[model samples]
Target: MTVYDNCHLGHARAMMAFDILARYLRFQNYKVNFIRNITDIDDKIIERANENKETIDALTGRTIASMQEDFAMLGLELPTHEPRATDHIEGMIKMIGTLIDKGHAYHSAGGDVFFAVRTFPEYGKLSNKNIDDLNPGSRIAEDESKKDPLDFVLWKSAKPNEPSWDSPWGPGRPGWHIECSVMSLENLGKHFDIHGGGPDLLFPHHENEIAQSECASDHKFANYWMHSGLLKINGEKMSKSLGNFAMLKDLFVSYHPEVIRYYLISSHYKSSLNFDSDSLDQARSALTRLYQAASLVPLQESDLHEDSVKGFIDSMNDDLNTPEALSILFGLAKSINSTQDAQDQSMYASTMKELGKVLGLLNDSSEAFLQYGADLTDEEISQKIEERNQARNNKDFLKADQIRDELVSQGILLDDSSDGTSWKKS
Candidate 1:
């Protein structure tokens, strides 16, 4: 996780998706040593610290603390090893030295070290792009110090008044790409089972890491790559510029973190999740329904339905197909809800909660989930009012009226006029 800023919804999506995956693996009795790296030192961190007029440590420390708080609140299981980049600088420097010793990398006259991309015959294999295609018509402006335009920086040259470390290539820091290779190598060895990240990293960041690591370490790396899809607002990418940027902190104020997790994992992990109030609405409804089933029968030991258990496992085994797994969970819930047979209800409820643990859902008591989960915070009510106004402005009357009805169902009456809508709770 980058320590430059607050973790947004996108960050939460990737982290939660992996968190459930790790849970399932452990449930399946696999020894999973999950290592999530913290990038404390980077160009972004430096720039952000300078902008905030704070020391790098101060900025990163605060951000890391906040990230931990947010993760804990979301009930994300802690990683087995959380290695910070600054803590592994020596590993990075040693790897850089190894790359330089090989014919795969070179030192620039400008005191920077760069990976010689042309030397690596399989440079574009991971990204599936031809080198000729990437550099077609001088598309990318080459850095004069770089041997080739595609050759990324391994160790950037130190500048005045910036953070620096004593390296063979003068005093400088490791580039973003080199940090991951070093951290992963240090934690998981030359070849690990899985390397996971957001889809955006596939191109340059991941592709560069592959080239640098393989060339440095006998052409070996992670065996499998898992890329999570993006989280967007409405249908477009969430950005501050797009006026749709959201922070997880703000969302937590409105909805429970578990609800957010449910919303995030409702769709398949590999598919993009379009987040909005409507999506959250569905997530809450579904989670409550599951909780409702668990509430139907007393919590006790009962034989789980073999078919439902097998179905859940099958769906999850199929590349974490959470949507199918959720349907199976709902099927159990439906059995409990539709039946008056106490023994059958107990059996289904036991199975529902048992399977739900793998996905980090259905832990809450039915009474609490039904009551607290339905209640909106004051901030959430205000936010809902704003969304309703937005819907009205766009002439989406159906959606506008729906938001109003949802708020009203919460026992909050709205007074509307030219002055705008104001809410009063009775």
Candidate 2:
């Protein structure tokens, strides 16, 4: 994740998708070495720091802390090695030198180094675009220093008051593309099992990484690439102009983090997710049903691996079909609801949670999760229930009804059985 600004739902979706993948893989007994890189030094990071009147280190440090806090709240797994781009500049310089030596890169007259797209025949292999048909940003535009519009900067010439590192191409920091190329090769070796990011990275960012890494190392960069689908806002692309752009911090004020996660994984990872208030409300209702069912069960181990659990594993094995996996879990919840047998409900709930662990959810105590956003504390709720009971015992039907209605307004539902009264979040 980049450290230029606060993390938003788009960031959360991509992160949660990958985190779920890692958890499922580990659940299957696979050793997962997950590496989520931090792009600490970027053009936007610099611009934002300057705008905030803070030093670059101060800006990035604060943002990284905020990112960590947000991810942890969403229950994302920490990466095995979280390498910052700034920490891998020396490796970037070494790789740039190698590319230059191999005639795939050149230093321009402006004291900048650029990768020659013409020199690498597989320049557009990842994006599957013709070199002539490509339309990159102004950074790759035809210029005096850049021989072709397709050529991209490996190292930039130092500008006034900008960060720089001493290199053969003079004192300038690495460009955006070179950071991942060098960092991935340095940590995961020249070749790795998988490379992943959001679908937006599949274009110039990933294409450039491919060209530069392969040309420099003379080998395949990654065996496979996995990109999660893009997220949208109510059938429209997210933009500040749309007035629907949201940040995770802002959304967390209204919805539970686990609700957000459940909503994100409700669709296939490769399918576009449309975010709206209604979708989140539905997600909350669905999760509430699971917790309500679990409340009837006593905690126990699920070594039996019931049919629903097998179905969940099947769904997940089919390319992480989370929507179907969730459906299977809901099936178990259905069994718990339909049956009066205590042992059956306990078995189903236990299996449901065993599957939920793969999705990083449903482990919370039933009362805690069910009453997650309730206005009253547990003690307060219990006191209210007792007051209502006393009112009923005194034959004050009006007083008892009033208390019950007030608690319902605060999302505390009451169940009056022959024995006594019990309360739960609505």
Candidate 3:
């Protein structure tokens, strides 16, 4: 789980999706060792730093801090180990030397060391595609510097004014793919349980990692590989050129972080997620129902709903089918709302909260969630409700209805119960 760039919703979808799996495994009493690496040094980071007229350290330091903040806002459980690529440069250099010694890599006349894709007969094993079928754009230019067109760089030669590290090949930096292989090997060892990332990494990135790592270690790189599906904004790929690139913090101005998290996990991890206001509103409404039901039960710990918990576990086991797992929560929520017995309500609420915790959700108090980020404060809404009650008592029904309508227009839904009126954000 190595993240780069501004850490947008696409990153959030993957992070939260994996977090759900990690938290679930932990709940099941499985000790999960989740190692998410950070790619601090890359061509993109260098370009951005130069464009912003800042030192590389200044840029990466700021961006990494901001990335951590964004992850916190999304309620992501921190990984067990988070190694940065720059911090593992020595290990990366050592691995590259091993590749060269094993004849899996070559140091070119141009001073760049490249992994010989042809040497690794299983080059396309993970991607399940032939190198000849790959688009020419996927590889570097077919220059004399590389032994073959498919050969990917392990060490990139330094350009003037660019960041580089002293390596056996020369004063150069590790290539993008090699960084992950080295970092993963360093933190989780040569053979770990799982390797995962966004779907885009399934091809050249992960494939290259597999090629380099297994070639060096002579053992399996990972027992399993998992990749989350792509996230699109309004059915279009989010790109700056398309004017659809969305920053996660910018989304927070209108939607709560929890709402965004729910929207992300509403779909299966391997299925595409379309980011749109309609989808977000639906998630918001769904979450509100769960919170409303949760508010009914007396706040006390109770045993989980056995049946729903089983359903959730089954869905998650079946390749992280979050949509089906979420259905279990919705069903539990419906039961909580329909049941009249206080004990039953408490049981249902407890189950929902405990299960939702695995998905990084439903932890907030129901009232807190309903009133979170509302335009009107608790005191303000209470004052207005009191004023409306007085209006109704004075036989000013029209004024009371008007006040209710006004609140509704402000995205507040007021429900009149026998006890009193309760409100939630629409």
- Name the weakest run of 10 consecutive residues (lDDT summed) in model 1: 366-375
Q: Assess the local accuracy of residue 149 in candidate 2 as a C-alpha lDDT between 0 and 100.
A: 68
The TM-scores, one per candidate, come to: 0.86, 0.94, 0.93
On TM-score, the stronger of 1 and 2 is: 2
Q: What is the C-alpha lDDT profile of model 2 across 240-342, one tens digit per residue?
A: 4456678888877666788888998999988888887688889989998888888887887645446787788899999999999999888888998999987
Number of clashes found in candidate 3: 0
* Residue pairs in candidate 1 whose N, alpha carbon or C atoms collide under 3 angstroms: none
* lDDT, candidate 3, 377-415, per-residue tens: 888988889989899899999999999999989888788
- Could you report the Cα RMSD, in angstroms, for every candidate shown? 8.4, 2.1, 2.1
Question: What is the Cα-based lDDT of residue 78 in candidate 1?
Answer: 94
**Where is the poorest 10-residue window by lDDT in model 2?**
236-245
State candidate 2's TM-score: 0.94
Q: What ranges in model 3 sit over 4 Å off?
A: 1-5, 389-402, 416-421
